[model samples]
Target: MHDTIFDQLERDGFAVVEEFLRDAECEELVAAGLELTRHLPDAPPTVFSTTEPEQQQLKDKYFMESNDKISYFYEKDALDADGKLQLDPSISLNKVGHALHLLHPIFRCYTYSERVKALCRELRLLEPAVVQSMYIYKNPGIGGEVVPHQDISYLYTEPIPPIGFWIALQDATIQNGCLWIARGSHKSAVHRRMLRSPEDRNKCIYDRPAPVYPESSFTPVPVSKGTCILIHGNVVHRSAPNRSAASRPAYTFHVVERKGNNYSEDNWLQEGENAPFLNIYTTSQMQ
Candidate 1:
């Protein structure tokens, strides 16, 4: 705690906070994350790709309607050639996403825990609203690579950009695909935008070229369990594929300023009237 998280975030576009949560807390979250799929309905398997592939575009209703539900997506390689899972659900699942914070009890409690409130206050996030939550299970041997990109590309806002809180429930290492970020890349413009197609509501389109970084530009950040990585909205970051025998579990979410920012209507995630994004300042869970 020598340098403040805010200072490091401003200087590097990302900050590492070690021991933010204890081992017991991390274990609780990991076990809770494992049960997320039980809340999902019986739908056809949907693959959550870290890389946007034009051939297997995930722009259908299943991906679009997950903003308010606890949804399960499978790892691409975990499925057989016929699109059926080749492994158990626990090992084949890629992530549970979008609404865990607002809908799930355990996730909601942690999302608004005292430590999170203190962190938000310290970062000076006035009128902050939760955008999305993800519990990523980088399953052993089949974990995919997340291509380098800026967060603003998906969660766009005018005037104010979003910030992400990525917490590791398991130890993150080079072998387990720890995050690699381009230092100070937030100073650059957003590399691309994920916009809803004008004609087709079921389609998602990219505006600019996808991010491509040099090998030497990124620095791998390996953190122990219960640590958090605060990422700037415009920072270029990505993770390699986990080919090791271990699993990497992480809980991440984004917060946006609601006061001075206009959330883009064409963004991938749109809040409904009945289930609007929760403001941390007024959420009862904060207490």
Candidate 2:
């Protein structure tokens, strides 16, 4: 079965593993998403933009600290003219990101589950480490558009780049901003990187120009609840704005092969020397 998964990934650049999570597992994650709001940390309102994340999100202190902390970001439409939240925090929240899989118990359990361990072994990742995780709330009617981009451009690794496990907590449909991935596009090299500037580590630097992809190169992948999509690091993908009344919430994390891989120092997400990325094989080494 794992061999089949690898085959599909090799052919398609992305593979959908239906029923990757049980109904109960999906419910728990969704419940945890709601529970997160209770522990809010007086976050100053900031809008999240995938296209210009460096300009919009990097400027905020909360975003810079989110690497090891579960932080909140609001949707642009969730705010009013004066930059105040016009809707409920639950309705306005764009995402709680960068470290839930490491810091939150519920998230940590799933991230280190036997099922995930099996995947690590299949990839021959002797020491698999997860550097980042996110719980994206693609809320109804005004959910934002995520511009086409590659995962390795951000959480990059040398020789063997990380892969993404994007699990859906709710049904993701075309009407609700389901992901649109370019078929077999992983064969292309990553032309740009969203890295930290040398002069200002807090700022971002794009090593090359963003490549333009034609619409015919992509396909919409609508999946039921509890499904998981395995995305290659260089796969070009994006999601349209959610125009329906329902939400398309998903939990995603990237796993880097720690055996013989070099994680770029200039990557926007950098953990201090003492606090390193969590090794999935070494549960006790949680950071």
Instruction: Report the lDDT tens digits of candidate 1 across residue range 5-71.
Output: 8888888999998899999989998989777655545777888886765724446687888888887
Taking all chains together, the TM-score of candidate 2 against the true structure is 0.94
TM-score per candidate, in order?
0.95, 0.94
lDDT of 2 by residue, 133-156 (tens): 899888898788999999999887
Q: Report the Cα lDDT for residue 8, model 2.
A: 80
Top lDDT prediction, candidate number: 1
Q: Which residue pairs does candidate 1 place in steric collision?
A: none
Model 2 has an lDDT value of 0.84
Worst 10 residues of 1 by lDDT: 50-59
Instruction: List all candidate RMSDs to the true structure.
Output: 1.8, 2.1
Instruction: Give each model's whole-structure lDDT.
Output: 0.86, 0.84
lDDT of 2 at 77: 86
> C-alpha displacement of 235 in model 2, angstroms?
0.5
Give the CA lDDT, 0 to 100, for residue 188 in model 2: 83
Residue-pair clashes per candidate, as listed? 0, 0
